[model samples]
Structure formats: structure tokens, C-alpha cells
Target: MSATVSPDQLPLQRLYHWERTAPNRVAFTQPVGGGQTVDYTWKQVVDQARRMAAHLQAQGIGAGDKVAMLSKNTAHWMMTDYAIWMAGAISVPLYPTLAAGTIRQILEHSEAKLLFVGKLDGWLGMKPGIPEGLPCIHHPLAEADAKKSYPGWDDIVAKTAPLAGEPVRPADDLSTIMYTSGTTGAPKGVMHTFANFMAAVAAGLERIPQNEGSRMLSYLPLSHVVERALVEHGQLQTGMHVYFAESLDTFTTDMQRARPTVFFSVPRLWVKFQQAVNHKMPQKKLDTFLKIPILSGIVKKKILSTLGLDQCIFAAGGAAPMPAELLAWYSKLGLNIAEGYGMTENIGASHITTGDPDSFGTVGRPYAPVQCRIAPDNGEIQVKAPWNMLGYYKQPELSAEMFTDDGWLKTGDKGSTDAQGRLKITGRVKDLFKTSKGKYVAPAPIEDKLVMHNAVEACCVTGANLGQPLALLMINAEATAVVKNGGKAELEASLAEHLKHINETLDPHEQLDCLVITSEAWTVDNDLITPTFKVKRNRIEDMFAKNYDRWVGMRKPVVWHG
Candidate 1:
């Protein structure tokens, strides 16, 4: 990777370059008119972005001002992001799934001067969260938010002329202030500069092969660093065509339409895809068919096409650890899901699998010019990279604590490097629990193992001060429905057998003493899981803390029906 990058390498400059070099090349595709779609060329994207930038400038929102974007992933969201940077402002993104309280806190904390609302599912419900005095701009596709008397997209574009200028930002200029999802604690504002994003995009492109004409589907929240880097910055750098998912109902259809060469998703979605396949064809039967020569080839093609992954060159799972069993299952069907590791602090630059079968269960080696080490005392992973964040916004003390005296950013995840430099994440350093027997247990790896069972949807291992660790199991909806019928006894028996199998493979200290089955579902709305679908261990522990003693004292291998 290049040690020194010019301003021309930044996203805004790349957008202008693409417009001049490939004016008519399709830049984005948005679903519209129910099932139809609309395409935006490179020229169109640049023109609209410039128009929006001019509008912002007319509104006295310029250089160093903060602008917030609240919406689901959409074409307008990308356009507005570019406009904010083009207007010499910082973009602040809020997840569409965020609660009203969170929205208010972020807006007030970032001191945003304007908000661009677009393509949200629950805009009416979230309306109460928006500050009364703040001004708003509605995207063309934001029907729900359009019901209010906010400035509309067409009005802004029609009344303002395109901003006329070359790139105005230096490499160190702040581009965005991204709020971290508060899984463990209150969210912090992570600031990333133009240089940081450029460095990360350049480093990532060196490892992951993407170029002009490469296609990607943008369904994940653009707010997250992973999607922002890969879809937004990656598109600008590589001139890739991006497609937007209209809704959850149309995700499969949209994926089929784009036929993206590179696809990415969280582990939770991958699990749901796996379950969908297994529901159609029993695992045993699928395994038997895959053992046959010609039939195996046909089965693999059919499965990939059915899931709209037939054209996928690189598929990734991140934001949480993916089970080794899940990886192997996909590998058998010719889809190698590369597991990666990174955090918002680093602009999602850390480790990624080599797409090799042997690289399974490990987030592979660091990118070029990036260095990583495990802290000796607590086994916490630490990294030093050009793409690391400038600092937490307005939190000097916290920012200082995030890095070592020598400047290596301290990642709170506990992990160790293999002989080949692959990273094996154990768990969060703060999430480690100590049993009454004085043994420390990392629940993440064990929980990953438990969820491999077909009946399990989510699992949490907690016994911070108890004699032995206990597993809280949330059954999948389909499995729960089965249990509701006459399958209750049978499902309990099977879960017990599965628990015994899992415990046999674990160390005695790490073994789960009992399993508590609950029918209640954990979701982002309920605070049991983060927006990225990672289970909040602390929240789960707190929810069942009062019953932990009794559950452990039962002295039974399976404490069924909680």
C-alpha cells in the first residue's frame, strides 16, 4: 500500500474523477415503483451530490459543521454523504433501528446543524425523537418523513445550482463522526479523517480484489464502519456499482437483481440463511446428496442461486465471531464465508480471512503496514495502523486511554495470534466471567459452539459469581413453534443430548452446568441484542441474574422450560 496518499485519492475526488472518466457508467441502482428499479449513472450521482452541497452552503452549513443522516440504506443516503463532505462538513449517521432516546442523545451530543431524513421504516415513530428546533431535509423516497413539512429533495435540487470547486479538504480534515452502538456501555463518538478513510480503502483494496464494474449490494447500515468503508468508500475508490435493498421483504429479490460479485452480511443473517436452506432440505439428506459426484455439483449451484449468491466472488461475515461449524457447513456447499475482525476505532481495518479453507475460524493477518500484537498481561489485541481513528470526539481523557503510551490502539477484544498470524478471538476482556472456583471463562467461544445446534437461535453463558457456568438458550421461532405443539418433550430431550455433547468437548471449568430454555426472543428493540445482532452479554446476565442461583443449584444437567 502507498505510504503517502494525495487528496485526489479521497472519496470526493474519486467521485469527480469517475464522472469525468466514465460519465454514463451506472453508479447506483435503487428499487422503485414497487418491483421496478431506477439506475443513477456516475454523472447523475456527481450532479445530485453537487446540487445538495450547494443547497447546504446556501443554508449556511459549511466547513466543519456537523450534519446528521437518519435513515435506512438508500441511494439518497449515499448522495447526501458525498454532499456533506463536498460542502466541507462532517457527516453523522444514526442507525434506523435506534430508539428515540438514542437519536436525541446523538443529535444533541454531536450538535448537528441539519438532518437528512430518508427511507426509514419507522420515521413516524421516530419523529418524536427529533429535536423540535432542528431543521430537516427529506429524501425523495422518504414518503413517511415527507408527510411532515420538511424541505424536499427536488425543491433543493431545483432551486440551487451545483457547487463549483475542486477538492477543498486536506488529508487530515474530519469527514465523519460515527457513534458506536452501545452494546457494552454508552456509545462514544468516533472521529475519522479523510486520510484515515483513504488509507483504509487503499489497504483493503490491496487485499480484497475489487475494481471498476465490480458489483455490491448495500443492505447493511451505511452508518457502521464496515459498510461505510466497503460500500461507500470502496465504491468511490474502485468505481463499483452499488444496489440498494428496498426492504427486508425484497432483500432476496434485490440480491438476485444485483447479482453482486462481492457480498457481506452479519453472522446472524448467515444463520437465518442456513436455517432457510435446512428447512427446505434436511441437513442429513443434503449431506447425503452432496456426497454424490454430479449431484453435489448440481446441488451447490442450485443452493447458491436460490439464495442469490450464485455470482458472489467474495462473501464475508463480521461484526461478531462466526461459528467454525457454520463456516464448514457453507464450505461444503461451495460458499466460503470469510470471517473478519475490526472495530469502529480503526475504520474497520484489522484482519480478514484469506478466503482459504484452512483460514476458517480465524480473522487472518493484518493489512499491509498494519501491526498487531496481543498484550502480554491480559491477552488483549492491540493494533497500530494509519487508518486508526484520530480520537473520540471531545473526550480527551477517554481518547488517551484508548491507546498505549507508544500509540498502539488498544482493542478491548481478547485474542491470540496463531503460528501463521491469524487472529482467534476469545471474547471481550470485560465480558470474561470468574466462577466461584476461581477459573476465568470466556463465554463467546462456548456460546458459538452451543448455537451450532439446529434448535438454538441465541445462547448466552453467564455465571460470574456462581459455582459453574449456565447457558441461557433462546429457541428459534420455527423450533419454538414445534415445541408449542406435541414436540415439547422431544425438543427438550434433543437439547439435553446436544448440551451433553457440547460439554464433553469443553474443559471442566468451561463446561456449562445447566441449560435454561426460554421462549422469549431477544431483539435490538428489547435491548437484548445490538443492531448488528450481537447478543449483549451484560444485558442478558442482568435479565436472569436473580434466577442464576436457583438454576445452578438445581444440580440437573438440563433445567428445562424456563
Candidate 2:
């Protein structure tokens, strides 16, 4: 009766079956250098994964071995992932953009033996990294810098036997050790089994109509569990077309070409996509046009084309809070953009907003298999599910703190349930900040409202003793990249308008008293954001502490220090 095979088989076993069933069908379509996406069939991918599995076993990687991967989102990345499980070793995924110190902490924490590096920017050379003989993998000469020397990925895969005996992979065996980013302290490794991965795939497919015929465009990093469980496992079962964005710059053009029926994105990217539509026809113009009723359809159609959400039915937003305003705006354009909430500890698939219109603001109800409860004392969300992680890899003290004695996984997010039982995440219990007056301000909800503004690409909310509500905002690079050669004045005016709009939408206390604009991007490396792309509040505040007064003196509605 289940959608998957016997629970006794490993995920790699399921993958081998899909290859036989749909041999020539496309498995993953990765991006090439200049505006091109390439495809690999299911059979070819499986054969390579098996060969890689064979090669890994030859290198002494068998059951219980932990193989760590630090790579960007690519076909080779996911293929190597299956190879690890196929060989019965646990997969340890490291965020490609993590700081060297953080990477060192995680690899050391997980006690990873082998690390495969796909392609990295300059930061890969930083010290205290994965040591030599760990077998670092890199892309061909294209992503490599001649000056920067490291082990090549091709040489290792080449050394692997093209064929080998079947590995003893079991369903209950540990499949991955996913390290979750900590809000208050160091990260922890969350262990998940092969059955957890497959069950999540089955449960997720119940929400959307995904199959071999359905196409998926994966923009999120493969390291994240939700992306991996859905895009990676679903492809093995369905022989679906999986296309990667050419580059972050050409993601929009890539979306249009892929014309994906099933798509997933983080809440931050979802907000920017909605804002892009608003910039084309400012809110005033849209309101005025909607009043006409006649021109509204035409105007909305044009706007949808610009945002490239013209034909996507299975669009989802996760990892952070999504504003009610932006969700309604896209819903009007006939997009099925729904909001969901989850943490890495749960294999990253949890409560999700349903396709039904009534399920709007709520993260919808929990999946049938997942039982969630609001804890009595501090309102921490707790999950009791079969797919829940076993414990932290080696930290018993941390692991004991994560669960109740009765077996509930304590999620630090604060939430409440509506009458219909749909879950609404009020805020994060840990992310709530105390003002100088000791008034608690939850930044997640406030940050959600501010990012709805078009020119505001990313923002972090912070205020210590002296400063009023200050937000460090990064301008939308894609929009500014095309302010054409000499359009600095126009870009400034647009950014000014965006700051004004965001300020007007907030309550008096929650209003951003000052805005810090910077051209330098906020990413995991610079320590401004997390692996899941959430802002690092402490780092942002420290970075701007000296220049905080200069922004307030500008007399502008917001600060522009770039």
C-alpha cells in the first residue's frame, strides 16, 4: 500500500530500481558556464553513482564510514551523495559558503574522514580546513584557479572501479549526519536513517503532484535536507527532469526555460520575487488598476511574466517567516506559493501550508505522520515523529537537551495553533531581542515585513543600548546590475523609495529608525548570514557598531554608507 518499496531496502536500492524502470529518462540537468543547462538520464546517473559507490568501497568506505561533502549544488554533488549511501556510509554535507572556522568546527565535530570539494570561490584556501588525504574533489579546470592547488575530484572518481559487488546497505542504517546551525551556540549533528529520507519523500509528494512527467527546478543548495529529500529522492522514483540555475545571475532566465511545475525557495528569495513584481508596477499603480477591474487582468498578467511565475503550480517558501501581504499578492496572480516552517533537526520537512486557499497564513497542519505540540511553559514547538533525528553525532550533553525525557524533539521556535489546527509560528523563542528598556522584540516577524520592499534585497534587525531600531539592508544586485552603465542617480532614487515604503508599513515601535545600506553582499562566509540564509544578528551589529552614528546623521529616512 505504500508508495515506496519494502522498508527493509536502502535508498540506493530504490535508486537502482528506478534506473531500470526509466533508463533513458533525465535525472539531473546542471548548468554549464554561459547560460546553458545540461541533462543526465536516470540510468546514466545510477550507473555512475554505483560506480562511484564501487570506487568508494575500494577506498575502504563501507558501512559505518562517514564521508563528508563540501560542495555547491551540482549533479555531481547529488550523485556522490547517493554513492555514499549506496556504499552504506553516512553522508555528511557541509554548506559550501561556511567560514573556515565553522567548517573546521563541523568537520571536527562530525569526525568526518573524507571530504569532497566540488567548486569553490577564493575562500576555499583558508586555513584550518579539511586536512590532506581527506580526498578533496574539485570541478574541472573551469572552476579551478591554477595558483590554488587542491586534489581533483575527477582523479578520485576515475580511480574507482566502474563495477563492483553490491554493498550491504540496510534501510535502518544511518544515512546522513546533518549538522544544524545553532542560534545560541555551536551547531549539532542530527542523524537520520534511510527510512527517514524515504518516508519524508512519500509524505511530501502527498502535498504536490510530482512524478516522472513533472519537472523540478532546484535553486536551493543540496546540503539542505528538504531540497535533498524532495529533489534527490523524488528524481530516483520518478525519473523527473531536474534543472539547475545557470548561475545566481541568470536564475530568472533559467526558470522560464525550465518552466518548472514543482519549485522550492527560501522565504528571503520568495520575498524578493514578489518585490520584483511590485517594482514594475508600484503598489499605488496596482491598487489603482485593480479598482478598474478591466485593466487589472492585463496588468497582473504582464507582472507575472516579469517575475516568471506564469505557470508554476507547486511553488513553496520555507526556512523563515513569509509575510501575509506578499503571499496574498502572488496568490492573486494564480500562483500556488505556500509558506512552510521547518528546522534541519527534523530532516527539514515539517508543517507546510496546503494548496487550499484557507491555509494561507498558517504553516498548514502537520503531516499525518508528524505529531507536533506546543510546550506548556515557554511555548517551544515540539515534534514527535518517526522521521526525527536520533541525536547529535557525538555530543551527548547537547543531544539530551534537544529532546524531552518522554521523547519529544524540542524545537526552539515559538508558535500557536488555530481553531482548525493549522500551525502559525509566532516567532523564535531564541531570536527575540531585548531592547535597552528590556522590551522584547522578535526580529523574524519585523524582518519579514521590511524585506517585502523591492530594492531591499536582504536585511538584519538589531539594536543595542544606544541605537534606535537599525536595519542593515543589502540592495538588490540584479536590479542594480542593470541600472545600465551610468545610472547611479536612478539607482539611488529607487533605493530611497524602497526605504520609505518599508518604513511606512511598520508600527511606531517596530519601525526601522535607521537603515544601513551596503553594496557588499551578506553571505555565510562574511558571517552575515547562516547556511539556510538567515541573518546572523550579532555579527551584523558588530560590523556596523562604529559607523552607526554616521547613518543617523545623514538626515535621510534610511542610512546609505556604501
Q: Estimated TM-score per prediction?
A: 0.97, 0.87
RMSD, candidate 2, Å: 3.8
Candidate 2 regions with alpha-carbon error over 4 angstroms = 1-5, 8-10, 35-37, 123-128, 139-142, 145-160, 164-168, 286-308, 355-357, 464-468, 478-512, 518-520, 545-557
Model 1 C-alpha lDDT per residue in residues 1-562, reported as the tens digit of each score: 2235787898778988998999999999999757989999989988899999988988999998999999889889999999999998999999888888889989998999999988877777777889988999999888654547698987889878998876567788899999999678877999998888888889889877788968999999999999999999999999999999988888789889989899989987898899989989999999999999999999999999989999898899899899989999999999888887899999888989976789987899998878999999999999998888888888899999999999999999999889998998989999898999999999998988888888888888899878889999888988988877879878878888988998899999998889998656898778898888878888987788898888788887767645
Instruction: Report the C-alpha displacement of residue 191, candidate 1, in angstroms.
Output: 0.4
Structure candidate 2, residue pairs in collision: none
**Which of the numbered candidates is closest to the native, going by highest lDDT?**
1
Model 1 spans with C-alpha error above 4 angstroms: 1-3, 554-562
Worst 10 residues of 1 by lDDT: 1-10
Each prediction's whole-model lDDT (CA): 0.88, 0.73
